[model samples]
Target: MSKVWMRTRGWVRRARPLVSLALVLAVLAACAPGPGSERADIKIGVQGPITGQWALEGLGFRNAVALLADEVNAQGGPLGDGRSIVLVEGDDRGDADEARRVAERLIAEGVIAVVGAYNSDATAASAPLYDEAGIIQITPSSTATDLTQHGYSRFFRVCYLDDRQGLFVASLMATELHVKRAALVHDGSLYARGLADWTQRYLQEQGIEVVYFGAVTPGQRDFTPVIQALDESGAEAVYFTAYWREAGLLVRQMREMGVDDVRFLAGDAVNNPEFAQIAGAEAAAGSLISTFPLPRDLQSPEAVAFSSAYEARYGEAPQSIYTLMAADGFRLLVDAMKETGSVDPADLAAHLHAIQDYPGISGPIEGYDEKGDRIGAGHVVYVVTEEGDFELFKP
Candidate 1:
């Protein structure tokens, strides 16, 4: 099914009473105290691919938002700013168009800022709407180099960008893992292609030859040819710059083809519990993947408390350590509102830009200049081990 069709059908099947309830709530929501409806607390919108291949990312973000909302409310709500804070949640279903539409709707609803749209393509599509509306966006997982290019002005990211992450992986392959020969395989999608190109250039610069650069489609059933090509090339490592679905197939196919020596490595897009679930525990057992650090020694008191509260409230463990980053992003906007003493979009943006070394849950996120690149080149790298799952590989 098409992305639109599937999204439409999914909503339609649940729309009957739910849609009516939504409409009624919208009408009744006029009395609610929010920046959009009132001059009080701001409405922070959160969006992500909640039900698609990258659902884990969205689920983690949603849980963090909910946790933060509760904590903020307990502290007398959304910085008060003379009013109450409200969270307006939306789903983008992993489609760029859906992400764009949802962002527009949130802006129309008067949100001061937005939290996510996990992948780069979705973030790239949704950011302009927030920019045109003069609302800020702090994505926990959008890593495309161009998402903030042209200074979307209103756009910000919690994670490192393409160059830092891609090059970090290249260095890991060259110096740490002893990987001399590699194949850069991607999903043929925007995020995959960008990361692949960056990693390829960096790998070559490090004197490591890329034996093959392969392309595969999302949801492609079998990866026999792709795996066969890598096996034939005798590459020691296969670097997959795609999401989990294709990564699962490629890893399994490599194992089935009797290519056990070829180590499979992936980027953050494929780093999740679901990868092991779909890719099978044994096939995924010895794989190597890169992701954010564990942050077990968080310096911020709020971050430490939030971690405990999250585990207690959710029961299940949180994926996406970026979970805490999303909450901190929301808090930063509210803090900006308080610091500026006005909800004027420009004033809020100014405050965010002036921020320095603000400790957040995922770590510290420093605001950017017109270029939107992180000032500090401090991206930590990881490796998936048979025993440790994914442990910090490079600092």
Candidate 2:
């Protein structure tokens, strides 16, 4: 070997162990708090329904975030800070009470941030708990109009909310579907109620007759009452603002009852394979849904890699592309942690406040405004095919 190459190889051999020892010493120095080193590991918390009715969505969030945590770890964690990421996951079981409890527990666990509570009610219920404890909250699927209202300092979302989704559905019905009349059905949950109310108001303002606005209890397997009401009201479309579990059952019952002519428009909650599972191919077929960016339509190589990894791990396609948004939520929290260089919610909230056009795996992200709403105007809609594939539709 050349003399220069020999010298370089000798230098590498001499420096490797010293560098490793220096890194270990620096980690120890981080724990002692000095001006010389950074933290060893930062704990990031994730809260969502790991069990109960929406476990599929909750599990999807968990799986996606886990994948991201691994990726973050592989990159040496938070850049420029010399800190590694350690993810602590909590299961809320899709219950409001459980969400609050999990929020409190995650805060007490010394976590810097939390990922989600998939439903609006759960997010709203747990926001104050996280805010008081200085834990930043980021969710992908909670879309109630007032989610970020009342100045929940740490609350943020990764996708469009009810007001925008409601308008998107209304416009799709009027301009695209050419439907002049409609009915609304919800699961009596806050998320469903908000979307349903907004859809009715927008349709009425647009000169469309909203003949029925109604609710159903969650876990109800029968929909004869609602379907009969819609049929009598002469609605051209029945807008469903409920989760897939209930939406699927309702649609199946409606079809069985011969109410097949009316177009079925659904909310983001129904944008998953579970809907097809519950209602079967024909019952879920021809149904339209509003949701986050489509996974199949993602243009980024990183996004494609995530989708492939998700499919490989789960033995099926991702339930919804919103999983990517949820993953982005956790990523933003980690980014915010790096920006503030501390886990304090107030500092991180300030960092979040200044974020503009953060290019994430899902798409562009804008932090909350004065009203705590994300400043953006893009949410997609998709239609379910009879063969159980989701067809991307322009929102």
- In order, candidate lDDTs are 0.75, 0.78
- Writing each residue's lDDT as its tens digit, candidate 1 over 178-279 gives 788999998876788888999999999998889999999888988888888998988999889888787877787778788999888898777666677667
**lDDT of residue 314 for candidate 1:** 84
Model 2 worst lDDT run, 10 consecutive residues: 1-10
Per-candidate clashes come to: 3, 0
Write model 2 residue lDDT over 349-378, tens digit each, in one string: 788888888877787776568655678877
lDDT of 1 at 251: 84
Clashing pairs in 1: 40-83, 41-83, 41-84
lDDT of 1: 0.75
